[model samples]
Target: MILTRRALIAGSAAATGLVYAPALLGQGKPRVVVIGGGAGGATVARYLAKDAAGALDVTLVEAEPAYATCFFSNLYLGGLRDFDSLVHGYDRLAAGNVTVINDLATAVDREARRVTLAGGQVLDYDRLVLSPGIDFVEDSVPGWSLAAAETMPHAYKGGAQTELLKRMIQAMPQGGVFAMVAPPNPYRCPPAPYERVCMIAHLLNQTNPTAKIIILDPKEKFSKQALFEEGWGKYYNDMIQWINPEFGGADVAVRPDSMEVVIEGEVQKVDCCNVIPAQVAGGIAAQAGLTDETGWAPVHPDSMKSRIDGNIWILGDSSAQGDMPKSAFSANSQAKVAAMAIRGELIGSRVFPAKYSNSCWSLIAPEDGVKLGASYEPSGDRIASVDSFISDTGEDAALRKLTYEESFGWYAGITADIFG
Candidate 1:
């Protein structure tokens, strides 16, 4: 009886930690186990199932019953969309071929090529795909931990936290203060915190016009810095105050009990706080020993295959690939490459050369949007940008509105591509 990694993590290996059916290995169709059904996992699972044409046994393991995308969550926060619009289910994924398992994947046994769920179900796989997304470094903030998250919402991962933060904002007193403790470099969404500030300001401007936003960013510049600054000047002039590390963004702490935010040992009471800490690969990747010292899984840029375990592929925010930012579009693109390679290995299919692309758009105000994106190819050992584009700082309203509308179309197309 070997102790499964799941039992060790759950502390359930108190006694025998026996295996139920060790003989289940290599007995069924070539198995493909996909963990964490987010942007990366869902897309890979769909392609593998569809491309295999029922030739491979594809199983998707996701704990959450429904998914609320973190990509467009800012629009919901901005009052531009409803929460239900962002919610999606996996029922559509079961097209009489793919098997959907809704349960927490406690651990992955790489050597035995099996996945152990919390419910005691063991899934043996021929190959594995992990797309667990980002997890925070709890100790990144001195006074902020998971417990304090109730007082200071990160909302970095979409779900109840997003709702909680929205409620806190709506209930904020007039002329109150909103503080955002931004994350360091190598985060899930590079432009998220800044885009969030714009959405928050929009909501506050209509309700609590006197409220002010204070962004304490560790980095001097952020994604869409010029556009965001220009929009802030035009729409909420002098309403948003950004403090870089040069001033006081580096040294910061939070006291949720008193709702006090301390920067450089100078404390000020804030009505609400959004704390986004440093990020790392999803927990399952660490448990499986796929991640390295950087706390992110190292993968081949062309195939998205984990360098540590050739049988497993890592995608989305979990992988430390190349220059690509951790964006939804990037994840979907990477997933396709992985899916194609995996399918080619499982069945005699044509594997094409890998070419990936990504585009990220942010809304500063109503119909006022900006974008930055690029297409990439494998260069030496990393993904190199071949062509790129970004919105000019002084783009007119018409172009900005078109960009915003393009984001909506992409949201619909990508979600359908992932779920359906």
Candidate 2:
């Protein structure tokens, strides 16, 4: 119920005064520099400080003082949750003795083992952990770029863009069309875009019943394909349409200025368009030179140590540790493993074999939630799924309601685990 981090910290230093200090490592503790404050970075920082009991200095460098989680942002768009509820501050983490630095990490000097911040601050670390989420891949979607985000809002990264998309959807004319250009594989949150479609449909069903929802997806198949399709048919009727590659979904272009989508040379005007282009490891990860040709940082299957650099570990969406979907749950799970490994190497704590797990839940209609999960272990050079489970199609109403409630519990529990 308390999630992995809290469950693991039962016997450790659970309460401690906050500390902010210079990034130098010679003050009787090995310093750790974490380059993102999302689920992975925050979890690892908290774990190291709590478990180490001041034996290590953990400094988390994140640009945002408060993080808006992309995990449940769809609920906000659907009017299921408030925007404030999705935003979390770093006060708890700062109170837990992890030095929180609000600055953009601009460069990583691997040979010198120092990080340079945009504010002209330098941080030195014995072990550097990069969890810098995802960045859009340039030219992945034709005629779409970061500059075009304002007109065609991706809304994939959470926060303002999400709010913008919700506003755009709300402003659509009656019986208008809502179009979503779903991302290809290896993007953050495999089922998120589809879940967004469901949430938007839920919103539109009440406000604009005649509003049609269209999905132009590049992938042939998606996560929870059967479950989503079942829920769509049952709740949305003829309100939603999905077009795959054979139907020009793969070849697409968008004109944000005109609010038009071109599919296989067929142009269509839409009231709202959500373009989720292809993505790569967040820019900072690639800046650190920890990423491979795949545009994601490669880590060892067991410890999450960067395959390119032994002194650095990568986590979450930035990491390409095979078989793990880039989700918050996977990041939290991987953070614990990395924290334990870092402690064992730096301060002589006991190290155990890495065991990881992740569960992703999506809401279709109200009280209709579906989930998929897997237990993983190191297999050869990758983290292989050992066991897995998913919600079955045509599950009873009570069971589906229970699954929805379970997701609520998981969100609260995981946020506490990551932030506190």
Instruction: For model 2, state the Cα shift of residue 179 in Å.
Output: 0.7
Task: Write down the lDDT of every candidate, Cα atoms only.
Answer: 0.88, 0.91
- Residue 410 C-alpha lDDT in model 1: 89
Off by over 4 Å in 2: 1-26
How close to the true structure is residue 170 of candidate 1, measured as C-alpha lDDT? 91
Model 2 C-alpha lDDT per residue in residues 331-377, reported as the tens digit of each score: 99999999999999999999999999999999999999999999999
Model 2 compared with the native: what TM-score?
0.94
Q: Which ten residues in a row have the lowest lDDT in candidate 1?
A: 16-25
- Can you give the lDDT of residue 153 in candidate 2? 94
Where does candidate 1 stray beyond 4 Å?
1-27
**Which candidate comes out best when scored by lDDT?**
2
